[model samples]
Target chain A: MTLTTQQSKEAEIGKKANHLVLVVTNDTIDKVYPPMILATTGAASGMDVDIYFTFWGLKLLDKKGQTQTKIASVGNPALPMPNIMGMLPGMTAMATKMMKGKIKKYWPTIPEMMQQAKDMGVRFHACSPTMGLMGMTDKDLIPLTDSICGASTFLDWATDPNSVTIFT
Target chain B: MLGTSLATTDAKPAMVLDTKGLLCPAPVVKTSQAVKQIQVGDVLQVLATDPGSKPDLTSWSRMTGNELLSVTEDGGSPKVYTFLIRRMK
Candidate 1:
């Protein structure tokens, strides 16, 4: 079949770039790290990586809310303490601080990682419906945002045959 | 004599990246970024302390079309791992 110029251009892009698509739906520190780490490393490996932040995950894209993210000390099996103990006042803060201390020793903070990912050409997409649902406009998002897109647009990118989609 | 010949054949790095205290993925990330600073086919020498860097760098070079020419371990107190990678593209 004969291909038009636009079609061939898209075909060329598809042949050249392998895609890594991540759908992040949570905002906790632990939940946020995997997608960020994978996206950064995947981009380093020469993949075209995209992260679609929806629901709570979209909150990470917000400048104000991004800094407020905390590690979940309650109801987390990975925590050394019992759930009842985790209910104590300041437990979340203590846990978050402890985790941050450990991570800071050898790794970049989440915000720094996001910046590195952006520098490495990892594209960040904010969910359009979620933005409306949360009453957030583009001005509320961090400067790293690449696009505001709906699920269909994200799916179109994710549907590439060479792409791998991860949901967290 | 063998060591002398091997040393003579070793490719000198066009750039060096020190990621000694940094952990996994960071070293790889930094190496990827550093590789871009040099011309294609130039070698990038990366020094890292994370134990996982050996495997991570090996896989990264293989996946990114770069050549993993050699890996040297200092075996010091922190056990530094050094990698020489040639960017093919």
Candidate 2:
């Protein structure tokens, strides 16, 4: 290929490769799938993927909390009515318990998903403020956390021109 | 109305990923890895379950600009889901 042609080809290749995504989730089991799925896909597509787990989302980092993460079905209009009917008075609490069972039946445990995310080289960040508020220390979180930072720190990573920020 | 199998097959399948018994991130994760090995225009066949794969595949295909040719259930295993994906370079 000629020099100009080669340069054009290189530019074309560069354009195809540019992808950056920032996923922020607040620990809702049902809500966690979006960010995890998006981040995994981004990394798979050769894009730089960063996931910022803040507030309740940070629970994924907690070894115990991750395995015990529950889905809130009460007041969540999305829960199937048939399933909701099974929950009596404290439906929210019952739904959470039932949802957890359903989730466990369908897919890998949250910790396993975390391992997969790490294996895919997806960057995992835990929010420091949330950690403090929840009274959780680094010892409580998964060992793979890239770092603990505040919202401003996450914003710095999300400001790139190619970065697509998503709040889940 | 036409069956999903009859849509089109002029292109060759570039990769085949068997994600049976795998859940959520595994299917997408494996598909992503498989896509990396093929060039644009190549197709990838993914077989998975976990229900979440449907939306996951659609969203990933849309996000990566890949063509999701088809997604069907394989009968042997009641939960089997298959996806035909064409790489978009």
What's model 2's interface RMSD, roughly to a tenth of an angstrom? 8.4
| Model 2 per-residue lDDT tens digits across residues A1-168 | 234643465465455534455555666777787677667667876678778888778888887777666666555677777665646667666777777777776566667766777888888888898889989888887788888888787777677666667788
Question: Residue B38 of candidate 2: its Cα lDDT?
Answer: 87
The global C-alpha lDDT for each of the candidates, from Candidate 1 onward, is 0.85, 0.72
For model 1, the DockQ equals: 0.34
- Name model 1 segments beyond 4 Å from true: A1-17, B1-9
Residue A58 in model 1: shift from native, Å? 0.8
Q: Given candidate 1, what's the lDDT at residue B1?
A: 22
In candidate 2 chain A, what residue range of length 10 has the lowest lDDT sum? A1-10
Across residues B1-89, which tens digit of lDDT does each residue of candidate 2 receive? 12322347644676778887766677877888888888766778888867898998886776565667777786664578878887766
True contacts kept of each: 0.65, 0.45
Off by over 4 Å in 2: A1-25, A80-93, A104-106, B1-15, B20-27, B35-89
What does the lDDT read for residue B3 in candidate 1? 27
Q: lDDT by residue for model 1 over A54-93, one digit each (tens)? A: 9999988998998777888898889888988889999999
